[model samples]
Target: MSSGGSAQRPEGLGTRTSRGIYVSATTPGSGKSLVALGLAEALHSHTDRIGFFKPVVAGTTPDADPMVALIRSRYNLDPAVCRGGLTAREVRKYLAEGKREEIGARTVDVFSEIAAQCDVVVVEGTDLVGQDSAVEFALNARLANDLGCPMVAVVSGRDRTPEEIADAVDVARKELQAAHCSLLMMMVNRAAPQHLDEISAAIRPGVSHRPVYVIPEIEEISRPTTGEVSSLLALRQIAGRADMEREVRDVKVAAMSVANFIGVLETGDLVIVPGDRADIMVGALASTFSPEFPVPSAMILTGGLSPDEHILPLLAPAPFPIFAYPEDTYHAARSVSEVRSEIWSGQRRKVASALGAWSKRVDDAEILERLNLPRPETMTPLRFLHELVGRARVDRRHIVLPEGTDVRILRAAEILHRRDVCDLTILGDDGQVREIAGSNGISLSGMPILNPATSDLRERFAHEYARLRAHRGVDLPRALEAMLDVSYFGTMMVQLGLVDGMVSGAAHTTAHTIRPALEFVKTSPGVKVVSSVFFMLLPDRVLVYGDCAVNPEPDAEQLADIAIASAETAAQFGVLPRVAMLSYSTGASGSGATVDKVRRATELVRERRPDLAVEGPIQYDAAVDASIAATKLPGSNVAGQATVFIFPDLNTGNNTYKAVQQSAGAVAVGPVLQGLRKPVNDLSRGCTVEDIVNTVAITAVQAQAVHAQTLQAQAG
Candidate 1:
């Protein structure tokens, strides 16, 4: 039954060029779908161009394969490629008629075509059912080898002793290895809580080459929803259709009196009783809506009877589903007990539960490392945005929003607060800020709002400002007047270490917002000039456009510094830095003073930081397109894979960023100022609430990096 070969040392399959993994199981009901879904989600954080393939599907039509549909819909994968793989009947018929060669060729051709277009693919194997067990095992092994991918074997641990679990894994591992398919990892699913340690210890020695993971049985993923039960039992809908998707954890038969039935009820319980039991039906429905009692998932009425007329209207508004069946109470209960919940397209709760459990239980880092899957080169817009918030939350930084009264700023503040991304302070009149927020439907209850004119820090900040600016200024009066302005006051907070960063410019000019920072916060110790970059979130990847909003026209050395700063910024934000110094012509194709400046800047960058992959005097097309780059700059490393784009001047950089932002519908997230002693970012006056939120998140992350560097320096 297995694809035959000598069992040699198990080597990892899938070279650096290979882009997929095959997930298979030794037995049916191994929770293979759960593992597949979780694996897809985990890979998504690394790359968005993930593909799913279920070669040898079970049903005739695509709709019968719900897992494929669910993965496609949830991750927004291409529909054309996401249809289920070959049907089970087709494969089974071919195998029965000894058409193994045809099946193998077709599977390889189809999988190659799909894998070529994706960064990674997850291939699910056929279920091992009665009479087809040997054929299924052979097919899974042959497909894994033919696809040039590693195999993840899942073993069902339910009702199995420790020795049995180990035996199952050992046999599967040896079979897969003999078929020349590398075993990436083995997962023992649905094992008893107390038996998990024993089972792991038993299987550890048998599969010592690869890791073994044991996922405890989770009921949330195992229980059927009310809608599924209705479909399974052919029951008639009484009412509460809106709540049909609620999950059923336990099923109870209410044959006793109402008092005793109430005591036995639990949350997500499905009650089965005769329709004539008015007391049980009414009480079950009432408890679902009550705050004091456990809410049942649904109520099943049996015995071909109906509830009282008054109960019908109440059922309509119940928080759970109500079903009526013609079968007697005993038969209905028996039918319910045998129902098995399955993972389907519409069961979003179950999908989410599976992903959560897998993320918590699996050691994904070790698996990815063993597979030799490198870090992805590009990031999607959504993943980038989420990573910003997640990175900020790890070490919460205090951010101050000076333009707090502006509606967009207030809205962004509310969102950041709800996400718990950062600790925030707003410098403005407390009462006026609350009033404006209330009118705009935003809550600022727990956020601190201060008025510089009435605050205790006003005098202290004014004194500090006067002392810092003593050579140019006369007295404390001028400093006090400047402190009344929110921008100046907020910048003082960052300078005094009261807040880690400040985001302004929503309603103010960039000059007005950054003037105080330039005066007091200044650049980092080694940096002579401060610069900024915009994170242009294009459809496929994120690009960094630097000095777009700063340094209008720089000389050669300044441009070099900007290039280095932009590269560092890109690396900090999870983008690999392949810098392209953009100009009007490809390398040495044309000559002019502008071109000369770029060429000199490129040389300066190479001289200063030899580690950076940089190329210059390149046109935009050559910098981003591989074919053009091949013709223009044949051996240049950074020409075709540029992630950080450094512009020659403000006129070129600003216009290009705007054109791309408007035409391509890209999300430009900065004007993020770099080289500051602390982190101070300026927003566009035309920015949206989302733009402000993103800026604050970026600021928080920047502050965290700065803090980490400082700690390292002190320890050294």
Candidate 2:
């Protein structure tokens, strides 16, 4: 509804003509470029009209942009058709030299030229939703708007709130404007299969008009990083890293579980067995990247029974890390099988990373607590129980609702609550909810319940509505009716400030559940746009993407808004943001409306905010590959080494993303909404119990963030 400034729109200069879809998000790292690239790769099954773009880049490399190179090489586009003009170093120079006008002019020229040559362009973003001085976000959005292309929004699943999803869609739609585009689809990537139903239902209602696709979290591949291997084995670190070591090397590992040992074992390996019959086999793991081990890496000893304590002295001198589990051989093997995925996927170097951090902490127990511990053997209950009691504080009792919710979600909630992690407020017809639970073989003894039909609806609504709707919409009767119609009874409890957050949508669309929030709770002040994010879980990597669920075609400012949201999302996941601006041409090489949009957006980002790290007019390679980066752009943090990638438009956003999902076996989490006032989350109509639980967690986090912000504002 609100435009940032004239700079948000891009002026079109039709230069090149080609055919392809452009995938761009409101922000970078929202899986736009990856999606586009994947889609282009996937289209191999359909047609080959696919063309890639890094249309307008902020800087240049020695020869051209890395993204352009990828598009040229993989997508089969002509080198002449490729668009990135800037290198990583150039982008840094623009920032350092303070050449705002030069940056804008370069971007416009690049995109314009690429748009003229390519049939479809998959554009990526630098950032989309947060407020920052960066201009690239705005530039990507404007490129899409100017080019009149559609877009698909991508989001993550972890702790996503319905309000966030709704807000993202709302902002994107508002920014893109229905008049300029054909359609918009929101995709929640990396959603765990178990949570699919609940998440789908929760998010469906909010996006009924637009197509919302939910992709399951695909188990991805994870291999040891070179650093990880060196750290794990205490091998000498090598410079000039290559995919393969220069020569065949022998490595060994020793641990309590054969399963743990097997994960790090490569082909042609030898294994040691404890004097136990069960030592021979562990259950099959999800993957064995090397398929078979001709030789075992190492032999493991099981149980406290010493295959020899003498081995410990040997282990201490060995190159690999070792472990001692006080369990039987069979039990150790079982533990290994249970944690096979983790063992196989984890980098050997996480050990070094862990040890490094652990050394700084004074307490050893805390370090053990933080590690994602594998399943351990049962210990004596008395001492363990005593320790647990001593460490844990008393948990406050709260209402728990069954309300015919899915078993998995309820179980997850119970688990979290039992651990004293959260206090839940559940709504339902208590007795019926319980009866159904009993019939369904669900246990609810420890949970608290409340009946909304018999509860004081007026009082609850008054409380929540007073806080959320106060001056904005005060028609209590009308609001109540609206709320009831949309299952607002539960939402009202939250609105009235009676509850921390609400997670729904396992049985509804995002629209159905999020509508009430948008209509009642509204957006935070100065929050002009909404976008989505996806927490992609690759076998070995985790990433966050945005604006993949909403916004058909965003302007530079809107893209900027998405970028801010994405950066914050990345921060939550413990990743640093190094953004990439994608287009057909890199850094002013081409001329077109799309390039102009990216140019202005880059300028906007550099001039408006100097603290953030970002670069544009580069392709996926320049943004991700360090080797290509050194040769191409040389000194930029983002080029050929970027973690956050922005796409150009929706068609590119939707198809390309899914292609990656299906092909690379990458798991995706959200289309989590950003830029909302309150924390309300939606589940997919087909979401599972896990989805519901995760959505609840996401809502909690959002609620917490909003609360913290409110306190800060009040204090200020």
Candidate 3:
């Protein structure tokens, strides 16, 4: 909220319609950053998937939007999202080319990418550059309208009379109305204590359509920390290093006599003057000790000077802090005054104080009810992942990673830990894994690291695996030898309930990852073979593509089992279970071995579970497009609304899923293995850190489903 202006009401960065709120400011210094933080805090109470996006930011590092960085770290969000935006240079270039609409388009593109990741993205309203206030705010209004998100206007309450604040709020409201963007509310941030009630009542009649709230200035959050002053103003702290987090309540230039300046001394004040003013410097230091005098929080010796060499001895004896700056007194004082309040990522004390202040000042119950945003009816990749993480946490599962020596696995493990998605155990030597993590700047500080070769559980797991594989001619010695392998050790852990599930194969082959599980852990009851599905995240909904991984080919019966299992997997992850038996034909239009197999598989699915909606021998186009469905398969329930597509073989399923993933920019989640007794998943060897994290999350959620089924069976 420190970027500029008072805090926003509700944080919303909408990639989808009706998902986020745009918080904009009509005037400079409205603390939009803090307002956004306030909104996000409230959003956290209802849901954890909050996103922060700033469409354009100037005078900051590229790709480091101050707002996005602050909120992402504070919320422990997946860093993959909300980081993309048009830089100031890009925006200016677009504006100069008269392609301003393109800016909106790009912002929307960024929104879509993050939209999949966040339940509600807290889109920081477009920052005003050098444009006129009217022009900038009008653009924000239009952008909000274009993004189809509600707008909450922030009005600066600092140094402004109630009337001035009301007029500004009125202007912003009109801009939003003129652009046809829904105005959610108006907030007056940093309002003077005396004007809180007055400011709330003043933005009325003309502003009556939406609610108005006023937040009084909190000095701790509204004033810059001494640390910021030192860093921003280049005021080198020669003393009082311990008090860097203290807030500068007031800034004073020591142009007056020592006596007069002493009169102005107050708690948390930063005094600026020429360094040669030894009398004032000594007096200011002494004031901290007097019962009659107020203590100065810090002092800056301007003109590139410090306290006289002799006088420096008396400095630290006093509790007051001091700084040395190169600028003259006038400029130094001006610079200190210009330092605005902010919430930075690492500034814990300030952020904590700011959040605490906003929590107390804002009315929570009333605001949450008024800004009641509806949940997205469509499932997005990010939203689905959010749901998966949420589900995994609800019935917390302990997931193990067999490729702990790989950096991707460690990074993912750190992410899973940071997000609190599930309990995790990494399979490798503790020292090697730890060294790799540290070398990559990754922290698995509190995570469990189990060395498969040395773990005491290996003895128990060896016995369990040997007993389960005795028919395969395995003995205790052979099983004990297998226990040294990470995949085998990890699978054995899952089978024996040492851990709930295993996610491997990032560094191993598919056979290397799943063979152990297949050999001992085995498939669940009534399951024939382990099959897989890829949840293709199309623009509007999620579609399941089955038989994509494990099995290369299957008989009609195995295909039917895949269909049935895929339907259940879809339901478990919150997708509807409409089965489309995909082939090269639509209905009876064509015939081939593949087509016939799909048709038979469809009949078998219907026979096994009449509750599932199933359609067979359906072309891809007919299964997805309504017009094609009407022409090819009239009166069919699953033809056009198919949520699960059952491919006849692994070759087709794998090819189609990849084609869609690349051509349509769809997110392909898994080769999620189904029909396992306990959850075990594989990852691509070339998978990114995020891929590992997502797979681990999926595995944990799968483990949760497994646990639920076992509980139900025991009860029955």
Candidate 4:
């Protein structure tokens, strides 16, 4: 990761320095919006104070750029600030009069003003097109340098060969670098799936210094919606207004008989014919509801003809849209074929699919590190939870919920299933769980429910548990008796690799929930004691409180281990760790057994993890409040900006977290246990559906990291 550009402070823009990233393309139709959308969505995980700008929009209106509208609506950006700096016509007119420098200066001024309000801004460049394409590309590079932001170039690989793809990327990279723009990354969009290896191999050696992402072609994003087609031909919609957003994957002509046309139809096909062809229109409308025949997206009546009175009555209840155009059938079909599909605000499914595809194909963490933008001062709770869910949905892991009969657990399972966050298996009697879910109006159709007492795995699991616990004097009969417990059964399943992780404790105590894992799964190698942390989501930022639910009182070594583990947990969830060892007194103002223990623990942490920043014997006020920090410990780095707060004892940690959570209206999402060999997280006994969902998501992400580490170890 490298920050390759010099800082520039433009006049009249307040002292606040806002970071910006420029997303541009080598040519038109490179799917630049997809990259921008995914980048924005990814950035939202880190911070919600984001702004979007287009330096040169094609039209004058604020809504002229569909990309801007899509981003604003999806991310809830301020509408007043999410507009282009200048229109295409305006830029062209200025350039024709040789005002190139004026264009760059104006862009810089507009971008800086918007940047002042946001932590970061994503600037989109004009598409490379028209007679001035060469000039436009050159201007894009110059604008990036003028703004002092890093650039990411998107190259189209839709119909290019491996050599062509490499050459195109090289040319774009050289152009941007020559203009003193820090090229952060290159994305090859719409490449053939089968040729991905060849294309990547050809381009990697040339652009080895920077990360290159290759996205295979997805056809769903290339298909225009019915509403877009209707707008293109200026057709008057007759019925099915609600279905206008349905995608049109193919275009078909209904010149033959109804029987022949039905045979030629395909799913998402747009049927075009004269209004007099009532048989074809009726047949196409009926096919949309049939399971056997392919469904048409919509039907177009050409030649400016209206359907007969009898036909209008039949089309009133159709599920697909019906449009009337003044052009003939031939001209209408030609126009529809020439209309290029694009992602717009109205087509949510397409935008979501595009984001998902880009997320799955690209390495977002690597890109963010390369850009190395400044971190936001605070993160909202909603944005934090949304990022957790998004990370869990990528390469999903199977998780088991032991207390299935509990209503909260069942409700959480339903929500997780609906969101497709993870694969779930519930432990309980299937019939009873189903009955309870039915009465609560919860759907558990796809989730597997099993009774520990009657499941076939009970015998096998008992045997395996007895063998693993033989050293602890466990017998086969004892193992069989223990397997009847849901927590024990679920833990054995994880040990046997049947599930990736386990979440229990909604109806049980913390000891009961974690005993099974301690007996078998145990802690990771070299870990002396297990610790836990609660993510206290405050109004402005996230804070980590350690040992709140685990150790009652830890010695210096245990406390140091707890601090290290807490810092790692915070970083895993996207918060940069700045360890603050909290005590009743700040610095050397007071001396006692408690303060001495904290001072020792701080020393141990610094000795063990030299790379981490640790501050100790600090009062709560001095640790968090900037003014108090300056008065108490003036030169400390972690005094006022600490993200991870470690308490000397459980009494302080538990009560402080509760006080802040209640008094400040914060969301405490944890007792996230660390140092486990496999991910087995415990929930609060009085937890809500949202709490269970968030804990399960966190567990899934932990399992993913463990799996990656195991693969890396094996390869090494």
How does residue 185 of candidate 2 score in lDDT?
47
| lDDT tens digits by residue: candidate 3, 1-716 | 01122222232222234567788886777777778887876665455466777777764544666667777766667765657477777877887798877888887777777777767777787655454566677667766766666777788889999998888877766655556666666788888987687887777654335457777675556667677788788767676534565567788789989998888776567888798999888887654444445566678989988778898877765555578888799889878878876765345445545554565466655666655655456665655665566567668889988888998888778667655678888888876776555433345757888997888898998898888889989999999999999999998888889899999988999999999888877789999888898888775578999989888889899999999999999998889898899888988888888888888888988998999999998988999888889989999998888999988888888888899999999988887899989989988888887777788888988988888888999999
Clashes of 3: 20
Worst 10 residues of 4 by lDDT: 8-17
In model 1, state the lDDT of residue 178: 66
TM-score, predicted candidate 1 vs. hidden true structure: 0.60
Better of 1 and 4 by lDDT: 4
lDDT of 4 by residue, 1-716 (tens): 11224443221122223388888887766888788888887787666478899988876764588888877877667775577788888888888898887788888888888888877889888788777778877778778777876677889998999889999888876766666666667889989878988988898444435557888776767888887888888888886534666778789999899998888887678889898899998887654354456567788999989999888888876667788888899999999998888765446556646765776678777766655556656688867887898889886999999998898999888767755678999999876776556433345768999899999999999999999989999999999999999999999998888999999999999999999998889888778788899999987789999989999999999999999999999999999999999999889888999999999999999998999988998988888989889999999999988999999999999999999999999999999999888999999998988899899999999999888888999999
Q: What C-alpha root-mean-square deviation, in Å, does candidate 4 show against the real structure?
A: 9.9
- Residue-wise C-alpha lDDT for candidate 1, range 338-398, written one tens digit per residue: 8888665456456545654565568666666665655666677766876677678779899
Q: Candidates 1 and 2: which is better by lDDT?
A: 1
Error of 2 at 644 (Å): 2.5
Query: For every candidate structure, what is the RMSD over all alpha carbons to the true structure, in angstroms?
Result: 9.7, 27.2, 14.5, 9.9
Q: Give Cα-based local distance difference scores for all models.
A: 0.81, 0.48, 0.76, 0.82
Q: Go through the candidates in order and give the clash count of each.
A: 0, 205, 20, 0
lDDT of 2 by residue, 67-117 (tens): 455556543466555555555456557757877455555654665566565
Candidate 4: C-alpha lDDT: 0.82
TM-score of each: 0.60, 0.43, 0.59, 0.61
